[model samples]
Target chain A: MVNRMILANVLHRPIRTAVSVLAVAIEVGMVMLVVGLCHGLVNESAKRVEGVGADILVQPPQSSFLFGLSQAPMPMKVGERLEEIPHVLAVTPVLFVVNSVANLSVIYGVDMTSFDRVSGGFVYHAGGPFQAPYDILVDDVYAKANRVKVGQTLNLLSHEFRVAGIVEHGKGARLFIPLATAEDLQGVQDRASIFFVKCTDPAYGDDAAQAIHKLLPKHSVLPIKDYLSLMTSNNLPGLNYFISAMIAIAVAIGFLVIFLSMYTTITERTREIGILKSLGASKRYIIANILREATLLAAVGILAGYGGSLIARRAILAAFPTLSVELTWDWRFYAASLALIGSLLGAFYPALRAAQLDPVDALAYE
Target chain B: MEPIISTKGLKKIFRIGKVDVPALRGVDLRVQEGEFVAVVGPSGCGKSTLLHVLGGLTSPTEGHVLVDGNDFRGMSDADRTRFRRHKIGFVFQRYNLLPTLTARHNISIATHIQGNGFNPHRFQAVTSMLGITEKLEHRPYALSGGEQQRVAIARAVICEPKILLADEPTGNLDTENSQIVLDMMRELNRTFRQTILMITHNLEAAAVADRIIRMRDGRIISD
Candidate 1:
């Protein structure tokens, strides 16, 4: 009977219930989307970097695991010396520019001869390698997204470049240009952000890295296979804190909305509460009923949030082809739990206040 | 037999800021088991306050109260609430049936609060006797005043409490509905031999009880 009353009370005020549920749904969805985008981008970028077929990577001292964040470029001669290491088959100088034209993207500048040799050559879907210093090579995904053809010109870094080729994606970046042109345009001539060394055998990767590290004592030299696993929010500075703060803000939204909703509902139901007490409802019983309503609302909101997040992920992927939003089950569980806990806490005080109401006064309440 | 209800020096004072306004002034009262009693008074005459004190809804500023062999003074709030659940049932003037629930659920809530499972036999018998069996599926707003009050009466007596407390049970009803409600109370008292204590301002409503006690200025005037 009490359960029926709870359900009836929840349904009695549909608008209030909807507002509360929507607030909770937005909170859960916000947390899931933020966490998903952060993790998805990092994992996607890491996989693309691994696709370069490099066995070893070298960067300037104190450079981050994220290639795009490497601010100080190392001298291009670093690639020449890396090729001398034992078991190193080829070395390529890659100077990347983090550009924001239509969207945020990293355009890698590579020396064609060494890049082709190190990456086993690009599998062209349309045109071939860069034809001129002003030519740009785009991957299939980028070409399809931007609707670019072989001869179409694109403005990158304030310079016009003709599209020379459309290659299969997964070669470190979606867009590429010749190394010399990139260095000249970027004002980093004779310098590269990273040196990608391809080894004769995968097993010689660590040895090549150790040899390179000994030569450039202060620089960062890492075996690519192992470094791929290190590219996570946990390993990245400030990323985890950023994600935590976003989740906290989401939970706070749920808590505040639920608190206000339950408080006002309790106040409005003062007379009804008196009726229940006069019927012999204990404090625990009253509290249980109130919390039960909150939990039911949260449960519905969680399901809505899950569905909304999936739809949003699909829409986002369609609108922004380069952006990856990976919705993990682990984060889904965490978001649901946080919403439930926050909602429970929000309803607690109002339940207590209702339970403490004097039966006589509550009965007399208008 | 010892009285079913006994109160000594029952006094209740409302402290409004610095002024102490007394609602029940040392009024001692007693009623036997299986008896119907009505407390009657005009506005500000402590009849409702006396009913509240006897029902354990509020504590009297000065008093000793014993009902059905349980001492109200020795019981904690939890104990009183439990006692109310099992031993006392209440009906109010406004027929405080939860407006959101169907008439059936409104009555069933009292039985639920007693932590007792639904008894189909008792439910049918109670609702049938009160003539609310056909109205059970309707919410309070759809029910007439007489029907709503009947539902409230059924809710109170469904758990078969030892005592029934009513405050102005017919105060909000039309003359015909008030008469119907009064007849049901009389029937409940006679058929079940239930102990009933009612507070009312209507002399006609008070006349239905076996005994009527009148009060004025917080003291018993006559019986």
Candidate 2:
């Protein structure tokens, strides 16, 4: 009976039903795209951090300055002191500077030997480890995107570095120069922004993080996973505000459409309801009929919305590859929640009108 | 035989500002089991009001309605709905078939609402008996007035209610369609022993009934 009723209602008003479905689909698609982009950003950033494979990352108290804009570099002397602590094993210094890719190359600088110790071995394919002051490695994705070749000299801030080999690291960006070259260009002799520490035993990761925290109370010592999560949450506040605003607007529009559609449906059916009541159909049956129609519309809208999300993901990816958004099934939560809300809100007025109709008055409406 | 439906001094009043207009004024009526009865009157004559009160669709301000000896005045609103669903069937003049459902599904809905599973053979039998078997799969919009009314009749009688209440069951039909509907109602009464109470303004429509009651000015002027 429900199936028959739903089919009937859908068939009766194709234009209205299609419009409702499109509204829901757009909402679902928006939510899917938003969630997918956020997830992608977090995943990519974490891959960069994990590429270093550090048990714990130790940075200067002022190192957070790199989070937003360029700042005075942290002194490299901090890495030396942190390595002297007991059971430290080894510490690799890290330098930070946003190098622009003009013409065709992205340049990053890091200490070649210490970087290898920290990562066990840099996952590289074309170029061997950094051997010269200007030697650097570019990952395959960046190389392909930029159309650059090995042994290429890229100028950055008046310094030229040799791209010794093309390297492929798991989702990490390219290295334009070795650590020494970056320090030389920045003119900071004793300071670097971060230290990547390798514990003698992987099980000692937490202990190492705690020890670093105790050693340098002013600086935050974060485990690899926690650091990645912190980085992911950094942009969450702004994203949350944006999402809340968009969702509120979407909900308002959804309700307005639903209200108008349901109102028209009831108004059109007033005479028919009278006829049913006169035939011995109770108010309960009438209300059920209206609600059943709303539910049917909602279900169709949700399915279309879900499908729209897939289309949205593909479109976004095609338009902006750098957005790096990957679609996932987790987005269904938003679709389901919004769909239920839409159906309930849409059905309320129609149900009330159907239930409260006076058979005599309704029949006289014609 | 005792009355299947009995109403005594049933009064329904509508309030407009400071004045109260009576719709059913001290009405007394009884419908015997298996009887085909019609209450006839002009527009605004309270004939429909009397039918509503008898069918438990509306409450009277000042009287009692006893259905199969059960006092409707004592039943709760939910109980009244339940009683209406189980003991009463309704046929409307405009043939209020849900525009979405096919004729067969329309009738099946009533039985489904009664929480009974679909019985294909029974539905086919009912439609065939009404000579609407060919149009059973057609939606209300696709069927003619007479076909739609037959589907309405099938919907009303599918649950096999103890009493069928109709309001202007043939008022929207032509004379030919009206006669067909009346013939169906007569067959239902004679073959199924179903008690029927109908309201109509047409005297010719009322002529098909076993008994006719007339109303005027919210009161029964003749029976």
Candidate 3:
């Protein structure tokens, strides 16, 4: 009966309930979207790292952020020296440059023969491998999104190149060209971005990395597994703080909305509360009633927020294909739990006020 | 027989912006078990204040209230709340039924507040006696004034409290509805041996009680 009363009370004030639910939904949706994007980023970065299929990666010391993008160019001759290391089967030098023309596109320049050897080679979906100096390969997703097909000419860094082939999804970069061509175009002929070193045996990766680190102590030599772990753990600078701030904002939004709504509701029901007290309702009973209402509202809001977030993810990916938004179950659960906690906290003060009202005065209240 | 309620020198002062206005002044009163006592007075005569104090809804400024031999003055606020839930039931002039709940739910909530589940037999007996069984599904707004007041009375007595406190339970009803509510209270008192303390300005309403006490300016003028 008390539960029914709570449900009835929520339905009695439609506008207030709607506003509260909408506020919670918005907060949950924001958290879902932000966390989803964060997960997507982590997943995409890990996939890119693993895609290299390298036992060890050597890059300039400071390039530990964003998959070595921040690193200064290392000398291409580092690959030749790494090839001299024991248990090192192949060494491929690659350059990565971010071009901001029609959104950010990562351009990778790789030595095709050594890249295929070190990175298990790519599976072509259309056309054939790079045939000319300026030939390029675009991944399936990017090719379809941008409407680029085989034999089509596309511009990167104000230089035009024919799309030589289409690679399988998650193969490598959206745009891959010959190593010398990218170096010449970027005016860094003798510089390479990073070196991918494949060990003769999988178990020798850690040993090979340690040996390379000894030779070039000024640079970072990390096994591929360690780099992937770093990305998944969100140890990157500013990333953890950014995620924490987004979660805090989401919680605040949920808290403030529920607080205002429940507070006003308790104020409006002051006389009713007084009557309930007169009839022998304890403070715990009153608080339980208020909390039950809040929980119901949060439950509805979470369901709606989950649906809205899924739709938002679809819309976001539709508009910006490059921006990955992964709506994973873990992120959704986190959003729901945070929203529930926030709303319950928000309703606490109002429930306490309701329970503390003087029954005599409340009954006499007009 | 032991007195179900007793108050000695009960005083209640209202501080209106630092001005001490006395609402109850050294009033002594007692009602025995199973007694139906009516307190009658003009407005601002502290009739309601005395009822509130006796019901444990408010504390006296300087007095001792003993209900069923339990000293109310010594009990904490939380203790008083628990005491009221277990021992007292109240009917308000406004028919303080939860507007959002059905008549049945409003009555059932009284039991729920007691931390005891509903007793189907007691529910049937009360609703049947009050003639509210058919109207149980209707919310308060859909009920007539007489029906709403009856539902309120039913809610008050559903838990079989030792004492029932009523503050002008018929103030909002028409003459016919008022009489019906009064008769229900009289019937409840007679049938269940329930003790009742009612505050009212209506002499006819007071006449239905076993005894009437009149108050003037916060003191009992006559009994």
DockQ of each: 0.83, 0.42, 0.88
Interface RMSD of the candidates, in order: 0.8, 2.7, 0.9
Q: Can you list the residue pairs that collide in candidate 3? A: A63-A71
Candidate 1 residue A351 C-alpha distance from true site, Å: 1.1
Over 4 Å off in model 3, which ranges? A65-72
Candidate ranking (DockQ, best to worst)? 3, 1, 2
**Residue by residue across B1-223, what tens digits does model 2's lDDT show?**
7899888898999888999999988989888999999999889999877777776677778998888877977776556667766777878777778777888888988887666567777777678778898888888889989889999999988888899989899988999988988998898888888799999999998998999999999998888
Tens digit of per-residue lDDT, candidate 2, span A47-163: 766787777877766555223243565677778877877667888776665665553323456777777787776656676666788676777766665566876786666667677
lDDT of 1 by residue, B1-223 (tens): 8999998888899998999999989898899999999999999999988888787777778888888888888688888888888888899999999999999899988888898888999999889889998999999999999999999999999999999999999999999999999999999999889899999999999999999999999999998
Off by over 4 Å in 2: A62-72, A86-90, A99-107, A120-138, A143-166, A169-175, A178-187, A210-215, A234-237, A244-260, A271-296, A326-331, A363-366, B16-19, B116-125
Write one digit per residue (lDDT tens) for candidate 3, span A100-141: 887765778988899999888988889878899889888887
Give the deviation of candidate 2 from the true structure as CA RMSD: 3.8
The segments of candidate 1 whose C-alpha lies over 4 angstroms from its true place after superposition are A188-190, A235-238
Please state the error at residue A42 of candidate 3 in Å. Answer: 2.9
Scanning candidate 2 chain A in windows of ten residues, the lowest lDDT window is A62-71
For every model shown, what is its TM-score relative to the native structure?
0.96, 0.86, 0.96
Best by DockQ: 3
Error of 1 at A216 (Å): 2.8
lDDT of 1 by residue, A1-366 (tens): 666888899899999999889988998999999999999988888988889999988889998877778888988777888888899999988998888887878899998888989898899999998879999999988887778999999998898999999999898999999989888878877999998889999998888888888999999988987788898888888899999999999999999999999999999999999998888899999999999999988998899899989999999888877788989999999999999999999999999999999999999999
What C-alpha lDDT values do all the predictions have? 0.91, 0.74, 0.87
The lDDT leader among the candidates is: 1
